[model samples]
Target: MSSENRTAGSGRLLTGLAWAVLLLGLWLWGREITDGSESGSSAPTTGDVAAVGRPPGVALPAAHKPLKPAKPQRVDVPSIGVTAPVVARGLDTQGAIEPPPYETPHTVGWYGNGIEPGAPGTALFVGHVDTETKPAVFYGLSAAKPGERIRVTRADGTIAVFTIDDVQVFKRDRFDAQKAYGPRDKSRAELRLITCGGAFDRKTRGYTANVVVSAYLTGVAEPRAG
Candidate 1:
């Protein structure tokens, strides 16, 4: 096994999500569907903000119509140099969506029980920011800026392309799962990528905040040839 496959410490990347689940009821009421438009505003000035809006002067593409429900086979964030396979994951006993196993830090975990990627709802994807000995697939997720692209290749062979609209790092104390995980627009297909962020707290055995990157479906590519 490579160094990236080494077991992580007791501090799991899902600690922030688990804490959110405890405080906000997570998938229950916290997953409330909401509607809104993409505002071309400046990013949040502070790391504690619940949600960041698109930076000014960044013209993002118009949203593409939602596609048929299809499982995501892979995810690629070119700006961050991320390209990883996606696997279905369910909520843990604590009600928090489980992340990819420590042994597979390069993989991303999709919420299998929720809306599929490219569908008309918010699709959630989670991954580790780093393993015990190295950075994982989403380690550079926080550096992803608005207007960048996130491509999710679906099992149907089509690639659902999403344009980043917001990126926020919510402090654990102020984390709002509803606003952070909920759909920004009910009419458009949205996606959320989450990972641990901020300073790691040895006392708590976790990070101090959660980085949530928001994007909406803006384009679709034909199935790649085998």
Candidate 2:
């Protein structure tokens, strides 16, 4: 081969080698990330529903009757001025809750094994505030405060009213799953709202804290007979 042709061939070989190295590095980096567990960084903290220990904020006797599904249709709280649609589902892998569909727009997560809203015990709901991709449904949840009036309208055209007792923020790892799932005063069913909060980690692209809203059912609408 002539000198110029030989030089051109060498250049192509170098380019191919560089591309191979780049692909190898990317694969190694992805493997390390997937194999490494994300522990310690997600320990639940105060304000987490899990913080509710054997002695909860307010504990009562076992539920009088087993919980039944009250499938909610709409939710309204005069206190925070939130009137959103209700969508209820089971838990997600991350353990954060989802929200119902409202004009505001967001997925509301529900507890699969817990009491259904309008049931005889506490019901649970959760949603995300913001992810790296999109903002979650419960993004405005932090704005809620105590003494707020919350109302949920069911598919049956019945409305259930709840009073916001308080709001708290807990670390991801310190989240108390038990407290979130435990029964409340037992007089009326309750609802707990959850979402990501606290410090934001750019590296992990997630919130270190979780916001929880504790509310109790004040009134339940009687179902209409078929």
Q: Which candidate is the best by TM-score?
A: 1
TM-score, candidate number 1: 0.84
Candidate 2 residue runs with Cα over 4 Å from true position: 1-68, 91-107, 131-136, 221-226
Candidate 1 lDDT (Cα, 0 to 1)? 0.75
Give the runs in model 1 whose Cα sits over 4 Å from its true position.
Answer: 1-9, 12-25, 29-47, 50-53
Report how far residue 157 has shifted in candidate 2, in Å: 1.5
| TM-score, every prediction | 0.84, 0.58
Q: Cα RMSDs of all predictions?
A: 5.5, 16.7
Candidate 2 positional error at 70, Å = 1.7
lDDT of 2 by residue, 71-182 (tens): 7766665654455556655323432222333333354545444556767666666554543334445656667766566677776666776767666666555544444434
Q: Quote the RMSD, in angstroms, for model 1.
A: 5.5
- Write one digit per residue (lDDT tens) for candidate 1, span 70-125: 99999999998999999998766656667787789899988787778899988888
Error of 2 at 30 (Å): 32
